[model samples]
Target: MKIWVLRHGQAAAQAATDAERPLTAAGQQEVRLMASLLQGQPLDAILASPYLRAQQTAALVCTELGYERGVATAPWLTPDDDPCEVLRYLAERQERNLLLVSHQPLVSQLLSMLCEGHRGAHVPMPTAALACVDTDFVAAGLGSLVLHRTPADLSA
Candidate 1:
């Protein structure tokens, strides 16, 4: 199975609430570039944070890919949520391809937890960056990082 983890692109510096934050114009372009770069990747499903920025990012990705369905929103993918919950949930799914659009710490921590045994590993996930993990299981250290790219990397 391959899990594609994506971080929402740059967002407004301030909002009424953290979840209310929206993506900037550059952020939309970043996500569009990222989506274009990922056109060849197989995606069976997309799960994303409910935050406005993440939702926007996922929407753009879904639109680009012509997924034709609303992306699933998982509360457990919130920035402050636990990665284990997502792992547990993923363990039951049969889909070989999945995409997760989320925030900063959550995305990085989940990558570390899957590629390393813990969340202490340094995995840089700048805005609109993506990390692809290939593994048979969802356990820590069982996966290999197949690809890690950013909008800047793809844009170039």
Candidate 2:
């Protein structure tokens, strides 16, 4: 199975609440460029945080990929959520390929847990950064980081 993890694009500096933060214009552009990378890839479902920025990012990806299935909002994808919970949930999913649009800390920690089998390793996930893990099953240490790219990398 291939799991694609994407951190939401850059957001406005301030908002009424953290979850209310919206993507800036630059964020939308970044998301669009990042989404192009997955144009021909098989993505069974898109799961994203309920945060406005994440939702916007997911929408841009859908527009780029022409993905018909709407994004599913997952509360567990919040920035502070536990990576273990995410791992456990993914293990039971039937999809062969999945895209997760979420925030930082959770994104980085999840990648570390998946790639290193533990949470200590730091995988850099800037805004709109993306990592692709190929795993036989969804478990810590069982996956390989086949691809990791950021907006700067893409632009370059």
In model 2, residue pairs whose N, Cα or C atoms come closer than 3 Å (at least 3 residues apart or on different chains), thus clashing, are none
| Alpha-carbon shift of residue 86 in model 2 (angstroms) | 0.5
- Candidate whose TM-score is highest: 2
Model 2 lDDT, full chain set: 0.95
Q: Taking the tens digit of each residue's C-alpha lDDT, what string does model 2 give over 1-156? A: 999999999999999999999999999999999998898998999999999999999999999989999999988999999999999999999999999999989999999999899989989999999999999989999999999999999899
Q: Where's the lowest-lDDT run of ten residues in candidate 2?
A: 33-42
Q: What TM-score does prediction 1 earn?
A: 0.96
Q: Count clashing residue pairs per candidate.
A: 0, 0
Q: What's the CA error at residue 105 for candidate 1, in Å?
A: 0.4
CA RMSD, predictions in order: 1.0, 0.6
What is the C-alpha local distance difference test score of candidate 1?
0.90
